[model samples]
Every structure is written in structure tokens, then in C-alpha cells.
Target: MPSVMEMKPLATFFVSHGSPRTLVDETPTTEFYKKIGEYARREGIQGIVWMAAHWETPYDTIEVSSNPNPDKDFVAFVPDEILDWYRSYKINSSPALADRCCGMLKDAGFNASLNSTAIWHQDVMIPLRWMYPDSSTCPPMSLISVNGRFDPYFHLKVGQTLRSLRKEKILLIGTGGGIHNLYTLSWHHIIYYKDTTPRTKPIENFAAAFRESMNESVVRNEGGPGLGRAMCRLLKHPHFLKCNPTPEHFLPMVYAAGGCTSYEDEGSVNAFGGENWEMNTQLNSNFVFGLPKDDTIFLGEGS
Candidate 1:
């Protein structure tokens, strides 16, 4: 007899919610998100289970935001325009859905909770709003807070814990930068990241190299057993540090990566933005683990 899990149909995704300006700027990454939105529309994704680099809890357990109104998180008000822009958008949440997710995780033996204290960071807002545009059409959403260790395996397990929901048409998205080297951020012109018309900034060579290597491992690697092997190889690879100065941002990918059963196909990766001091190398590359229904091209939702 097949267990309930074997009957589910679901796919997981990893999306990069780079700088706050991602929505306002014209970039390939944002365009890529629109593509994802189109895919979601056709697939009829019921809701989203997503996490942002901004939220982290010291506790070892996982948390689901049960609040329908997540706080407009982020305190940097230096650029009044940025703050105002972030607050202008009225973002809503789904307490019922969030509680459901927390229940699922807890059932899986994961330390999970339904949190009323959850705040919606722009990391969740920007990309989602850009993709769905119309808030009403956007699926019921819940936010996950990262644990203290930022353990890749733990996050992966956290994602795996929710695998059952995939069949229910819920979309699992992990939002964060592909490479987060905060020490090198161009804080001087932080507000005008997109103003660089011609030349973009430079990121460490090793950063880009590591990201490429990871892409190859996750996307091109073959065999079910090969997945673990590839991860081992990449983690020990020389580019690890250059790719992630601190592991929090990269942890989201680990969560997203865990969604695949094995040999999941990766969609087109759109690497963009080099304006920050981290330069061209601090690219926010994104990946999708499951194949789209029919792999149809073009934009917008279906009839």
C-alpha cells in the first residue's frame, strides 16, 4: 500500500529577492519573477510557503506567521522614499493557511509554531507583489523564519516536511540573495542601486564562480544518489566562503532545494544586477526545481 505522501504532486522553487528596488527596477530578475507569476497562474498555485533573509529566530524551531496582517518590517528610513515606497503597498496574509502549515510541520516532528508575531518583510513583499501584482489574486501566503544554526540540512528537512502540501497546489518559494556578502555592500549609494546606467559594481570573483558551480551541481547533476554527493562536493569546494560571507541568505536556497524528490529539472536561471559594491559577482541567480505544465512560453495567465 502506498503512503499518503506518495500520492501528492508538487514542485518547489528558489527565487532571489535581491535589493528592495527589485520591484521598481527593470531587470532580468524581476522579469524572471513575472515569468514565474505566469506559471503560477496557469498551475493555479493555491498559496505560498515562503521565507525571507530578513527574518530569523534564535530558537531552533520553525515558525509560521499566523497573522493576516504582517508588520511592514525593515527599519532603515534613511531614504524616506524607500521607506514610503515599502509602506505604500497594502500586504495581506492568511492566518488560517499559516496555522495549517504549522500543523503540518509539527506533525512531521519538526519544532514548528503558528506565530501571530510574524512580520512581512519586503523580501516577501517585493518579489511576490511583483509576480502577482493584484494582491487579491495572489495566493494565501505564510512566512517562515530561519533557525539559529542556518543549517542547510535542517532547512532542507523543513522544506521536505511540507512536501505534502505541494499536491494541494501550494507553492513553496524560498526568497533570499544567491550570494550575500554584506561586508562589501555599497552602502554609500545604497538608495540608488539601479542608477548605474552603464557600469555595474564588482563582486568577488570567487562569489560568481561558486554560484555557477552550485548551479551546475543542483541543475545538471544526475541520479538520486548524486544529489547528496553533489552537495557534499560543493560545500567543501573552495568557493564556499566567497559565495556566502554569512550563511543566512544562502540557507533559503537550501530550503528551496529540499523540495525536489530527485533529479528535478531547473528552469532558466536569470542572473542580474551588479550595481552594488559587491559588483557584478554579487549576482542574485534563481532556480525552479519542477517543470512547468507543458513548458509553455509567453507571458500572463491563461484563459
Candidate 2:
């Protein structure tokens, strides 16, 4: 019989890390991150490979966090107890995982490089560090946005390369929001003060549309045309310019999902409880390209 990690199918996820405010809010988004970390601990994952929007590369290079002492300042505001819990856990940042992904891509006739100079200490990872402080030490891999252009075929190719790493029991995580138009949304004002203005309606609509599209992608088991169409519609949405001024942040999730063979719900949590309220949600969205019964990892009960 295969080992537990080997037995479990490879998983992929596209999580909404919300804005930086999530680190300090008593809202749903913060709760969502907490729930996700708890679920991961329960799932018995050896380690997670994060593909975060915060760690963008300038070209086609893949940047791997090879820092001997990865930055921990991202979670400076986290409670001591939470910080201790993470410090006590034995988490490994799998730099080797990054190498594996790069190798796979190179063997498949794709030009890929491993970059270690990139900094990922921004919106997404900062909040993630707070939520999963114990796992913060885990190795992360990043793909740079090619001058703001999104090539679906190239992304799919990267996903295909990532498929090989899943067999080794790495949980691949793609972090970013479905709608990430920071400048236009005025992320600071809305997530903090609870703005109910009608202007924000477009943001809500975009979020709802994103959720629907994700659910559809999971249920349908294929994202090629359907997913692309939904994304295109989002880009054309009137408020698109405000919510996602650029596609770089939004595209990472797509690449993460495209790499998976199958997806499973680990858990879902809601952070706030008001109309037009900010929703910082987390889901143990698991993915496996196409591994047989060789995949079955459970991470605690679903919320």
C-alpha cells in the first residue's frame, strides 16, 4: 500500500487572501484564514507550496523562496499564542519542490528559471503568514507576470508542469482574490469602514460572479472555454477597472486551478456577517490532475 501522502490525491487551491486589513479585522475574512490553517493541520499535509500573487516575477522566471531564514515580519501583528503554535510545529519550506516544478517545465520544452531575489512580503503572503504562522516557513514558488499579459496556454503549460509535483504529496496553493482591483475599490476604506455605497455594488457583483464561475469550474471538471469566458466577462464588467486594475493578481488563481486534476472542498469559512460586508473566505480547495485511488487526504471536518 502507498503511504498516506502518496495515497492522497494531489490537491490545488485558489484562495482569496483578501486585503491586508484582514490581519487586523475581527471580520469574516480573518476568520476564514484561521479556519483554513486549522483545516490544513488536520489534513496531515506534509507541506504546502504557495503560489502567491504577492511574489510576482518580472519575466517568465519562477521565483522560489530560498531564504535561509524566510521573512517572518509578515505576521508581526499575530497573537503570541498563535505565533507560538506555529513555531512549535515542524514545517518545512520545500525549496526542492520549486526545483521539481522547474525541472518538469524544462524537460517539457518550456523555458523556466528559478529566481530567489523576489520579495513576496505584500498583500497576500502577509495575511497568510498571520493565519498560518506555523506553516509560514514552508517553501513558496512564484511565477512572474509577463508584463501584465496573461497567456492561457502558457499558464496551462505551467499547470501541467506542476502536475508532476503533486504526485510527491505537495499541496499546491494559489493565493489571490477573484476580483482584485485594489486602487479602484479603495481597499483601505471599504474593508475597514463598511461602505454601503451603491458604487461598491459592482465589487459585490464581481465577487458573486467569481464564486459562481469557480463553482461551475469545479462541478464541470473542465475550465478551458468556460473559465476563460467568465474571466473575460469580468474584465469587461463596468467596474472591472476599479476592482482589478490589472490581471496579474487575478490570473494566478486561474493558473493554480488549471494545474489540478481534481478538486475537493477542505473547508469554507465566512469572516463577516453584514450586507455588502467584506468576506474574507478560505477553502481547502484540493486539486489533482488525474491520479487514481492513490489520492484521499482528509483535513479535519468541513465547516
Question: How high is the CA lDDT of each candidate model?
Answer: 0.65, 0.48
Model 1 residue runs over 4 Å out of place are: 1-8, 75-85, 148-150, 191-203, 222-225, 228-233, 262-281, 292-294, 297-303
Give TM-scores for every candidate, taking all chains together and pairing residue i with residue i.
0.82, 0.64
Name model 2 segments beyond 4 Å from true.
3-6, 72-92, 135-147, 187-215, 218-242, 261-303
Alpha-carbon RMSD, each predicted model: 4.9, 6.8
TM-score of 2: 0.64
lDDT of 2 by residue, 208-294 (tens): 665555444444444334433443344465644545677666555556655552232222211111122342222212222222222
Clashes by residue pair, model 1: 201-274, 201-279, 201-280, 202-278, 202-279, 203-278, 203-279
* lDDT for residue 119 in candidate 2, whole number 0-100: 41
Error of 1 at 52 (Å): 1.9
